[model samples]
Target: MIAPPSPVPDSKISLWTPFTFSLFRAIWIASLVSNIGTWMQNVAGVWLVTILTTSTLLVALMQTATSLPSFLLSVPAGALADLTDRRRMLLFTQGFMACMATLLGTLTLMGNISALGVLSFTFLLGMGAALNGPVWQTITPELIPRPVLPFALTLNGVSINVARAVGPAIGGVIISYFSPGYVFLLNGVSFLGTWIVIYSWKRKVAVSSVPAENFIGALRAGVRYVQYSPAIYAILIRAFSFSFGASAMWALLSIVVARRLQLDSSAYGVMLSWLGAGAVSGAFTTGIINRRFTVNQRVLIAIVIFTGTNLSLAFFPAAYWLYPVMFLSGMAWLMIMTSFNTTVQLNLPKWVQARVLSIYMLVFQGGMALGSVTWGTLADHFSLWIALVAAAVWLLLSAFLAIPFPISPAENLNLTPAEHWPEPTVQGDIDPDDGPVVVMVEYMVKVADIPAFRQAVDQLVRLRLRDGALRAGVFTDVTNPSRITEFFYVATWGEHQRQHHRFTKEDLAIETRVIHFHTGSVPPRVTHYIAFPKAPNVDIAPPFENMEGQS
Candidate 1:
C-alpha cells in the first residue's frame, strides 16, 4: 500500500523572518535602496518633462516610455533569463541603466536636456528594467527556502512601496534645494549598489545535461504554456484590468497636484507618500486579510474600494481629504497586486517559471503604458476630473470578470518532476536533430469503459501539448470499438526527450488512472516514429513490441 502524501510545511511566516537569511537580507536591503533611487528618478523625470512642456499628453507619455519596453521585450528577456545565468544578466542590465542615468544627469546639469531627451532616457531605463524583471523574479526562489518565499515576495513589494513613500519626498526636497539633475545622479549611483550585491553573490548554477533551447523555441514554449494555463490567463486578465484603471492615478497625479490643488513640489511629494503609506500598511496586514477572505473576494473588494477612492479624488476639491483617498488607493493597489503575484508564483513550475512570468509582466506593464496614453489624452481633451471618474467606472466593471474566471488555490499542485517515463529502446544511432517525431499510445478497453477512457485521454491532450507536443489528437479504430489511439507530434526527436523529462507527479497519477481503465491483457502499446527526408527509400517502422507491464 502507498503512503499518503507528505504535508507542506506550515508557512506561518512573519514579516521579519525572511530577513534572517543573510543572503536574502543583503539583496533585499540592496534592492530597497535601488527601488528608492528608481522612484526618485521617476519623480525627477516626470517633473522635468512637465517643466519643459505643459502638454498633458507629453507628460503622460513619460509613463508610457517607462512601461512600453516591458511589453515589447519581456518575453525575450524571460527566455534569456531561463537560458543563461540570471545573475550575470541582471548585472549587465543594471550597469547599462546606470550608464544611461549618468549620461542623462550630466546632460541635465549642462542645461542640454530637452523634453525629447528625457523621454529617450526614460525609454532606455525602462528597457533595462524590462530585461531585468524576469531574472529578478526567477532568482527569488533561489534566495530563500520555499516556506518563507511568500513573505519574501511580500517584503519585496513592501520595500518598493517603502522607497516610494520615502523617495519622492526626499526627491522633492532635493529638487527644491538642488535640482532634478541631482536626483538623476543619485539614481545612477543607486544602480551600483544592486550591481555590487549581484556581483558579490556566489550563486551555484545548475548544469543541465540536455542542450539549451534556442531563443525562439524557448519563447514559443513559454507563450504556449501561458495559453494552456487557465489560472495564469485569469491572473493576466485581472492584472490588465486593474492596471489599466489604476494607471490614470499614477500618470496624472502630478498634474492633479500642481494644477488642481495648486500645490508645490513639497506637497506633491507628501501626497505620494500617503499612497505609499497605505501600500505599506496593506502589505503588512495582507496575511490577516487573506485569512479572512478568499482571493476572489479580496480582489473584488479591493477593486471596489479603489474605485471609491478614485471617485473621491475626482469630486473632492480639498487636498486634505485627498490624502486619505490616496492612502486608500495605495492599500487597494497592494491588495490586488499581491494577490495576483502570489498566485502566479505558487502555480508555476521551475522549468517554465521565468517565461510565464514574463507574459504576466507584459500584460501588467502594457496595460499601464496603454492606460497612461489613454487617460492623458482624455484629460487633455476633457478634464482631469472626467478622466478620473471614467477610469473608476472601468475598474468597477472589472469585478464581473471574477465570475467567469475564479482564482484557484495552488498549494496542492505538485510541480516536482516525476521522471517516471522509461528511456526509449532504440535500434540504431538516431541523431538528436532528426526530423519531426510522432508518439502514439494504443489502449484497449471494454465497450462500457470507452467513454471514461475518452474523457481521460481528453484531459491528457492538454498535458501533452503543454509538455512540448506541437499537435495532439485522440482517434478510435473504425474496425474495433474497443481500440483507441492517442497521438502527438513534436518538432524534433530531442523535443520528445525533453517532454519525457517534463512530466510531473500529478501527470503520473493521471496516466495511472487512464491505465487502470484499459482492458487489454497487457499495458497500453506505445510507439515512436521519426521522419527521414534524406532517405526516401527507407521505410521507418515501429521499433518496439507489446509491452504489458510498462506504463
Candidate 2:
C-alpha cells in the first residue's frame, strides 16, 4: 500500500508534521527503538551499580559515568560532525555503542562484572553517545523543510519520552525476571535498526570549493562565534544553570526508589515511566504554551514546577504522591530542554551549526556531570533528603538567572547564507595560505553622522569577530574627521574567503545599516592587505606551490 502523504504547511501546524517525510518518520521510529533500548540500559546500568555497591556515591556515579564523556568530547565531536559526513558519523557511533553494550552484557552474564567494570563500560557507551549527539542534532533540518523544524524537534522529544514511558518498565521487568545483563544485550541489539535505516538511505553532502578548515581552526571559529553571540551564550548560561540544578533528580532518584520508597527495581522503573508520561503529555501541549508564554516565561514556569518535583522527592517519599510529581518533573524537563535546544537550532547558521551545538551539548552535559557528583557527594555525607532539598532550593535560585540572560527570539532574522559578497580583485595571483589578511573599508561620514556611525560600527565589530576576524578596529583620520576606516584581521587568505561566504542575511542587514551612515556619493572603498614575513636573502619559495597541495 502507498504511504500517506506528508503534512502540508499551513496555519496552526501539527506536531506530527515532521513524521510525514519518509526519512524523518523512519529515523523517528528507529530512534524510538534505540531510545527505548538506551533507557532500558540506563535502568539496568544504575540498578547494577546500585546492587553491587550500597554506597550512595557509587550509585550517583553511574550518572557521572554516562554524562562525563559528553562533557569532555561534545565540542570535538561537534567539529567533526560539521567537518565530516554526518550520516557516516552516525553509523559509526551507533555501531560503537552496540559493541560496547554487547560486551558489557557478555561480561555481566558471565558473572565477571564488578561495579568498576559496569562504570567503565557505561563510560565507553557514553563516549559513543557523545560522538553521536551533535551529528544527530544537525541532520534534522536537512531531512525536512524549515517551517516544520519546531514540530520535528518536539516530536523528537516525544519519541524519547514515549520510549521513556515504556522502556524503563520493560527494563525493570527484564532486570527483575531475567537480569540487567539481558537489558544491556537488548539495548545493544536495538541500535541495529537505526544503523540499517541510515545505511540504506542516501544523504546529500553540500558542495564547497573553498578549502576545508583544519580541526583546530574549526574549534577556534566555533568558540569565537559563541564568544560574541549574546543570544546563544545567554541560552548556554541558562541551560548550564538549569541542568546543574535539575540533575539531582536524575542522580538520586534510583536511590530514593530503593531506600526512601522501599520499592523494588520494577517500581523504580514505574516511577520513571510516570515521569516520561508527564513529558509526553507536555510535548503535546507545547503549541499552546508557545502561543501563550514567552521563551523566558515558559522556562521559568518549568523551573518552578521542577522545583516542586524535587521537594516532592524530598518530603513526600510515597509512590502515590510521586506518580503525579514525576509526571510534572517530566513535563518541566521537556519544556526547559526543548526550549533551550529548539532556540539554539533556530538561531544557528549551517556553517557552524554542529560546532556551536557541540559547545551547547558540552555546557549542558557538563552541568549534569558536575551536578551529579555534587549532589551525590551531598547525599553520601548528609542525606538523600537533604540533597533533594538543596537541589530544590538551587533550582529556585537558578530561575533568577533568566532575568539577566533572557533568551531572544530569532523569527525576525534570516540566518541563511546570503552569498552577497563578490570575489575581491587582486593585481596578481596570491597564495591562499599567505600571511594574515587585513580588510579595510573606508567611508566618508558627516560630523553629525560620526556618532551614529560609531554606534553602528560597534555592532559591525561583533559581526566581524563572529564570522572569523581575529581583531577588529575603527580608526578616524587625523586630518579629516569624515574619513573613518574600519578594519578587521583574519588569520589567512583562505579563512578570509570562507568568512566572505559565512555572512548571513542577518549579518548583511547589520552591514547595510552601518553603510547607511556613509555620506559618500559612491559606496565605501574596500581594500585588502596580506602580511609579508621580513627576511634577509631568504630563498622564498612560491607560497602557492605549498598551498596548492594543501586541502
lDDT for each of the candidates? 0.84, 0.88
Q: What are the per-residue Cα lDDT tens digits for candidate 2 across 390-478? A: 99999899989877898998655688888988888775666677759889999999998889899999999898999899999999999
Worst 10 residues of 2 by lDDT: 1-10
Candidate that scores best on lDDT: 2
lDDT of 1 by residue, 1-551 (tens): 21222323456566677777777788899899889999999989999999998789889899789877887889999999888888899999999999999999999999999999999999999999999999899877777666566667888888989987888778888899998999999999999999998898877776765656888889988998888778889889988998898888888888888898888977877888888889888878877787788889888888888688768767778789889888888888888887788789878888888999888988888888788889889999999999989989999998898888888877567878888888778767667777599899998888898888888888788889988899999888999988988999998877788788778886888788888888878889998888866223477654467555568
Which portions of model 1 miss their true places by more than 4 Å? 1-12, 46-61, 106-119, 179-181, 252-267, 375-386, 534-551
Clashing pairs in 1: none
**What local lDDT score does residue 446 receive in model 1, on the 0 to 100 scale?**
88
